[model samples]
Target chain A: MATLEDLSKAVINGNVAKAKKLTQELVDAGVAPLDIINQGLIAGMNVVGVRFKNGEMFVPEVMVAAKAMSQGIEMVKPLIAETDMPSEGKVLLGTVKGDLHDIGKNLVGIMLESRGFTVIDIGIDKSPEDFVNAIKEHQPDIMGMSALLTTTMLHMKDTIELMKEEGLGHVKAIVGGAPISQDFADEVGADGYAPDAASAVDLCKSLLSK
Target chain B: METFNTTRSNFTRASFEVNQTIFWQMLSDDQCEEIFMTVQELLERTGVEILNEEAREIFEKAGCWVDGTRVRIPSPLTEWAARTAPSRVTLCDRNGKRALRVETTYSYFGPGQGNSFVLDPHTGERRKPVKDDVAATAVVCDALKNIDFVLSNGYPTDVKEAAADLHVFEALVANTTKPIIQYIPSVKHAQAILDMAVAVAGSLRELQKNPFFVYLIDADGTLVHSDETLAKVIFAAKNGIPFIYHTKLVLGETAPVTPAGTLVVALADVLVGVLLSQLVRQGTPVIAGGIFTVRDEENNMLPWGAPEVSLVGTGMSNLLRYLRIPSFGFAGASDSKISDAQMGLEEAFSMLHMGLSGTNLIQGCGLLESGLTGSLVMLVIGDEIIGMIRKIIKGIEVNEERLARGVIDAVQPGGTYLGEEHTLKYFRKEFWWPTLMNRNRIKDWTEAGSKSLGQRATEKTQSILQTHQPEKLSDDVLAKLREIIEKAEAAL
Candidate 1:
């Protein structure tokens, strides 16, 4: 029987196949699903987060580890009750309209998911209506918009305004990108602003806590 | 030149012939070849997007595949263009005298251009820069011994936007006699700036022969060149002005996320400008380099202080050296908002790394806040840093005299060498003296008001501004420069 420690090590090493196999072994051994998630997968990702913050690991390495942890999470997710599942929060992410840049948004999604948030990425060049409809569909705890161009960043304000018109103002909104700053975020009436992906995760957590 | 020969005479045959100097390489011969081959494949397969119709026509005439704006250059054309581009470019001062030689492993340090804000030397507040800031920057750069060339450190917002490049050039030419690298927005500005340079050089032919200033033309990244950029490239080539075919690659946005992938894209982007220049005029002098920045994944900003910048920048320099093109790159820049410890740390490391790599034109001397702000204090600090880097990159010489066998024998049994004549003969050349750095004892430092590096640098900058008198342009040249600026303003 595979111990939870072995599963955690597999996820930390980013050995996706071994992580999946060990997760299966734990499931066959009748380990609890919540225990497998908290001890095996999140435990490994927690180490990755620390290592990344301490500069011992880089973005790609953390990304690979997150992939491994997510794969293991997928295996045991069906066995758990909806209320019993571990989730920090739900976040909807997209690049603003007329902007095709998505690398930053995708990285934020990966970081949020690794921290146990349910992330729904709406993809690139999303119009204001697209953001409102996605927020209505996902009913996420936070909405994150990204834009790489100065021209396209204006749509972030439009998206927030449309959200207010659609009576979705209770859902906190966050803005980020190369051109997005805290002053612009405040001007756009966003709930918060993050400079990069790591801070985006923190911004979401802080907004949710508030 | 006589002094150089005299200094070299001390090296014995064995020491002179052997490669004993310390050097740094980011890529080996095989790695350079692999990257070069990958760049060629990328250029042929993916090609570049040339937005100018004339540039597209030129590519088509050169037997490249031109589909609308997408131009695919063959490997042979790139190889041929690399061969035709001059390996050495000499930049002259305002007097049309050769001052800087851009070839081989020789590196020259200078400030950057296009900063929007200036750190007020007196008030220490960030504000929009005016035309006087450009002249002040030039004056400081002229007085600094290590800064080999001058670039307008701040973009003058007070001038007309269309002819701001001309005004900045006028200010630089008026204040400093050092060689300048000009930043122009369009071909019109390029022509006007060239007119002002010609006024100083006395004629276009005389200007081209000694080419005091270089035009900076940038390629929009992701293998794209805009219409205005290509026009300036063509203009500079046709007029026989040296220009840096440069671009700034932001990882994961305008370029690939990985360093090697970014290198491929960077080389392809710069080569588009290079090939276009050579297609316009054979033997056109072009320097190839770009400000390589990694997008800080945490901040979502293209950070100037990242170590990856040095790594990728040195790699690009090595590639340019491999292709036998003069290289330009960024160093002595910081992301910090002030001249703090972080600024010093970042600037020192990047300057040391690029200096050791021997990049031809290492820019970014006075830049702060990731190139958004310019600080004269930072320029003074960078001058000191470059002086130290020059000593480090010179490496140690091994000779019968430098090994000091006779001196050691004479100073045996723990005798003091501080009083020896041998120490007196070599101490000045062997040591790098700091102008702004503090080396006083703690008591003496406190007695001297306990100034920090930033305070000392500020004092040095103010002193330079007050005391240093740069060589002025002649009255005839001044009147012609004024007429050209007036015409440019009227046109605008």
Candidate 2:
């Protein structure tokens, strides 16, 4: 039997071809899909994340390894969906209005999704009303706001104020973006401020738990 | 003659003490002079336009020979510099003095939370400055180098107090060197700081002798041929103060989403600043700076290594070099938190690109949270990174002397060359020994406390603060500075 360790090594090696083929082969060999995912794919990715978080690995390495894991997941996703599996959480992410940048937000979404959180990436330049509507409809556990420019990061506060005005205070607001600091996040009345995508994911996880 | 020598020795009891380093060891005083001369020749040979006629006259008077676009300062200028350049400045109060020894190649203070794009400490806000904020900003400038010749940051809330606030702030920070970057918000403050600078310098002639100050202000954000910012730039340049043309290109709003378009906008803004600098004071330096930003798909303004950012930076650097203007560029900037993976990646790439492109000074260091926060911890990390980048830029020098002693041939009979004088002399010069990086075995590392880079950096900061007692300035100079500050403050 092909062990999870074998699949984990494949992912670490950035062998997308091998990881995908092994995932399918293991599933075909009557391996449980959750075990294949949790014990194999996620287990493999966790190492990558930890290594990346520790500076043991660099961006290009992590990026390629992430790409490999995603490729493996593509093969197993539908099969896993057919089974009764619980999700980590749902996160609705967007950049506030007047700010069109989103690389940081995208990284956050990828990391969250990798952690099994279903993320609704609403895209950038979204108004506060758009966020409220998304929260109303999706009822996501967390709404992440991102802004790059110092001037535009101010719009995150406006969005939060608008959210408060609209009586949507129950929804948790997580804020990020370049130029957005813990101090600014505090002033803006955000539930959390994350410096980068890795921390953002960690913050979201902790917030969801709370 | 013997009596005269003794008195001269007494007079020169304490000229100055500088931060000694490998860079200092590499160049003798004569070599430093030669390099400066070479730089001047390079500046003149490059076709950077000299726009100001008055500056041209000054350069001519100073024996600065100009051939087409080339400019060269006569040896007399260097001699004059040795005499007039004060070693230290004393910024002070009635109680005492705060003297700061000047450095030839080190960062002075840069205004704004440019060190880190963070919220203002006083108001807990992330926008423009008010009066008190401007006054208190002197603390930031004071914490920097001692010879603050200009009022750097926190422009006043109202135009009425602008000049006065700037003067007070400049006085508080200005110890010995005249403040170069003083933006008198009003005609009164402008006149005041200028007057104070001239007084401190001893005369208008002295003030004009070396215009090594900067003044920060803004221009109208229009693409038109004429603008107030340009006018301010012109005025400062004409007066011998270099202007920093600072602009931020916010992707998706102020600039197009594409990095190219964003870079173009940044380049255009800088060109205007440079043009204004040249037109106002030919041959005076102008920092054509651009802080470019981008928003990703989810609206997160990520610290991206957009090739366009580097491309434009390199292009601008080349252009400025062609123009023979000293260029200051951005490097070692990271949106990541301290000592993390993101920090490693962000800092490494940013430093490499900026250094490779030949930026004269990389301003945003020791900042975190997207340049909104400052951490002493991060600042030390930045220093290390700067050292690393310097090594990368100082490409290996291969020569017959360096190859040395015919060592390989000598060692053909199984003799070791390790005991040779050549190896002893050259080895130390050829290698950079780091202060904090650990290369010990695991056992030794554990035995030696297993301290991380952060811990080591913290220890170093504490050591510098505790042990490095910078030389103090005279009480008279300190009193003069305080009096000027008080007058400026009362005026405000």
List each model's interface RMSD. Answer: 27.4, 24.3
Q: CAPRI band of model 1? A: incorrect
* Local lDDT at A195 for model 1: 72
Candidate 1 lDDT by residue in tens digits, B81-121: 87788999999998989998899888899998878898988
TM-scores for every candidate against the unseen true structure:
0.68, 0.47
TM-score per candidate for chain A alone = 0.93, 0.91
Model 1: runs farther than 4 Å from truth?
A1-210, B1-17
Tell me the DockQ of each model, to 2 decimals. Answer: 0.00, 0.01
Q: Write the per-residue lDDT of candidate 2 for residues B1-492, one digit (tens) a residue.
A: 111111112243365644232221222345434444443343334322334454454446655666643444444443333233232222222122332122223223223233313334423345544544434333333333321222333334444443445444443344323233444444345445555555555565555554334444443221222234445555666666445566566567666665545544554445545544544445545555556656555646645344444544544444433334455455455666455667656655666666665554445544455665544444455556666666666667744456443655544554433333344345555767566577865645887899887677666644543444333345665566557656766766
Docking category for candidate 2?
Answer: incorrect
Evaluate model 1: give its TM-score: 0.68
Query: How much is the lDDT of residue B12 in candidate 1?
Result: 42
Computed on C-alpha atoms, the DockQ of candidate 2 is 0.01
Best by TM-score: 1
